[model samples]
Target: MRLNYILSDLGIGLKRNLTMTIAVVVTIWVSLSLFGAALLAREQVDLMKGNWYDKIQISIFLCTKDSGGRGCTGTEVTTEQKNRIKQVIEANPDTAPEGVFGESKKEAFEQFKKLYKDSPIVSTVTEDQMQESFRVKLKDPQRYQNLVSAVSGLPGVDTVQDLRQFLDPLFEALNKLQWGAVAAAGLLLVAALMQISNTIRLAAYARRREIGIMRLVGASNFYIQLPFLLEAILAALIGAAFACGTVWLGWYLFVKRQAEATFQVWQWVGPTEVFQATGVMVAVGLVLATIPTFVTTRKYLKV
Candidate 1:
């Protein structure tokens, strides 16, 4: 009997504020979807760092004489220096690193020219003009600084460059975007909570007469308040369900499908995470909805 009454009250409350209920559902859905996307992006960044960063290496270019009096400065790297660098790399297991070295000056030149094939300046350059470089792959890419510091002032070494420096800006931009999504979701969540509070308060006002009658009949405060609280919780649960659905659909359509097609190497968040996130959103909505309903009914039920 008590459950029936609670359900009845919940149905009537939802009917009375149907527009506001829809608004709450939509708001929560959009907010959680954006939040989920941001989380997935963060996850992808971490995945890339773990799986791809170690594979990237630092390249040390050897100096050679060129048009100007650049001793081993501007010209092609000599055969002796190439052999010496190879020997030093193979000998020093600590710093030489274990990546394939481009032994012939022609090989390094070909790679450089191929990389800049579209450039007009590169079209005029020949293999003899390019310097040989040691492509050093490290056991741990994070230790790139150690290798760079060690090789910078060494003989025949012109420049030491880490691949991470080139990718830093992209990761920084992604970080900023993640924070922006979080801030936007937070603001929308606050708005949804406020709307839920207002709707529950209005429902209480509309039922004041019935509540007065209950109090006059010697009904317990708990009996009078339970139905209203249940009503609010029911609404919250419905909203949370909608939010979860939105997140799942958005992830499937936008991140997983689109990103996989565009960037084969990138990883996306899976359904399990979406379900977990939805469960959290539902819990939050339930608490937010129930607290205000309980507080508002206290004075009304007492009368």
Candidate 2:
């Protein structure tokens, strides 16, 4: 009998503030979805770096006589200097590491032409204009700065450039985007919480006369508080469900399907991970809802 009354009261309270309840659910759904996307993006970025960073090499360009001050002065790299550089690299097993390169200038130029076949400007350039470069793979990519310092001052060395330097700005931009998403999600979550609290407070005020009568009749505090708490739980659970559905649908359509079609570099979170994250969000929302409802009822319903 008590359970039935609680359920009936919860149903009526929800019906009375249907619009507010819907608003709270939508807000929670948006917040959780944004948070999930941000987390997934960060994970993908880390995964890509781990998988691809080691394969990248530092290109050390040698000076050539015809090469203008675009860093490579036209002083052709001498055979002795080339051998000395190669010897130094070979001696340092820790830094030079292991990787194959174009065996001769002809092979290097051919490869370069092939790479830039679509560019008309590159097609017009001749072999003499091309500068020789030593492609050095590192044992540990993280120690690339050490290799750069060691090679930068050598006689024939024109420039020593790491691939990571070019990619750093891109990763920094992604980090900023992730933080922005998190901030937006936080604001939305606060809005959802306030909306839920206000809805419950109004429900309690509407039942003040009945609560006073119940107090006079010596009803227990637990019995008086149960219905309001249950109402809040129901609202939060609904919001969580909505959030989970939105995340799943968005991932399926946007990240999994659309991203693969447009940007092959994008790696999506799998369904299993998405479901697990959604379950956590549901649990968090339920807890946030319960705490506010419990506090409001304790102060207002003095049964």
Candidate 3:
């Protein structure tokens, strides 16, 4: 009987403020969806960091016949200079213990041809035109600058190029995008909470007389507040449902498909990530609904 009364009151309250209820649901849906997207973005950035950082190498280019740097003479670097450079790289503790490899002119030429196979100049370049180099993989990819400082201007060294210089900007951009989503989600969540508080206040105000009668009849405060609490929880759950659907569709249908077809450099977030995001969204919804309803009822539904 008490459950029946609470359910009836919940229905009446929802009907009375249907517009506000819908607004709250939509607000929560958008906020939680953005939050989920932010989580996915962070996962993507971390995935790329793990995959690419290990692969990134600092290339120390040696002098070739055509090399024009101050460190490069007009002759090909000698075997002695090359050996000296390798010794310097291997002796440095900053470099990966097993990651240094010497690329001969022939090997460098072959790699260049493979990389630029479609380019018209691939036929024009020859093994003698390619400069021999040492590819040094650092223990920490970010410490390439230290290795570069150690190797640059050495007898055979023409230039030191770290791949991280190219990759860091992309990662930084994605991080900024992730933080932007977080900020937007935070603002929307605040709006959702405020809307929830207003809806509860209005519902309590509309049923004030009944609440007063219940109070006079010695009904417990919990019984009176139960309807409002149920209403908030129901709305938040519906919103969370929407958020879950949005995240699942985005990950399974759009992001997964597009990334599988086009972006292969890093692993994409999978169903596990989606499930984690859904858990967060649902938890957020419940907490957002319960806290505001509890506080509002305790303060305004005194009768």
- TM-score-wise, the better of 2 and 3 is 3
> Which lDDT value does model 3 have at 149?
82
* Deviation of model 2 at 84, angstroms: 2.2
Residue by residue across 1-303, what tens digits does model 1's lDDT show?
A: 877887788788889988877876777667666666666666767776776676687787787664332234655556776677666655544453447466457987677777888889886887766766788887767777766766666557667778899777878888888789889988987887787777777888899999899899898888887777776676777767777777778788977788767956645667776766677767777776777777777778766
1-303 per-residue lDDT for model 3 (tens digits):
887888888888989999999999999999999988888888878988999998899888999888886678888888898888898899988889888998888999888988999999998877888888888888887677777887888876788888888898998998999999999999999999999999998898877888888988888888888999999999999999999999999898887898878958777788887898799889999999999888887764464
Local distance difference test, each candidate: 0.73, 0.75, 0.87
Write down the worst ten-residue block by lDDT for model 3: 294-303
- In model 1, residue pairs whose N, Cα or C atoms come closer than 3 Å (at least 3 residues apart or on different chains), thus clashing, are 63-72, 64-72, 64-73, 64-75, 65-72, 65-73, 65-75, 66-74, 66-75
TM-score of model 3 vs. true structure = 0.94
Per-model clash counts, in order, read 9, 6, 0
Q: Specify the highest-lDDT model's number.
A: 3
Q: Return the lDDT, model 3, position 49.
A: 91
* TM-score leaderboard ranking: 3, 2, 1
Ordering by lDDT: 3, 2, 1
Off by over 4 Å in 2: 68-73, 91-96, 99-103, 212-222, 259-267
Over 4 Å off, model 3: none
> What count of clashes does model 1 give?
9
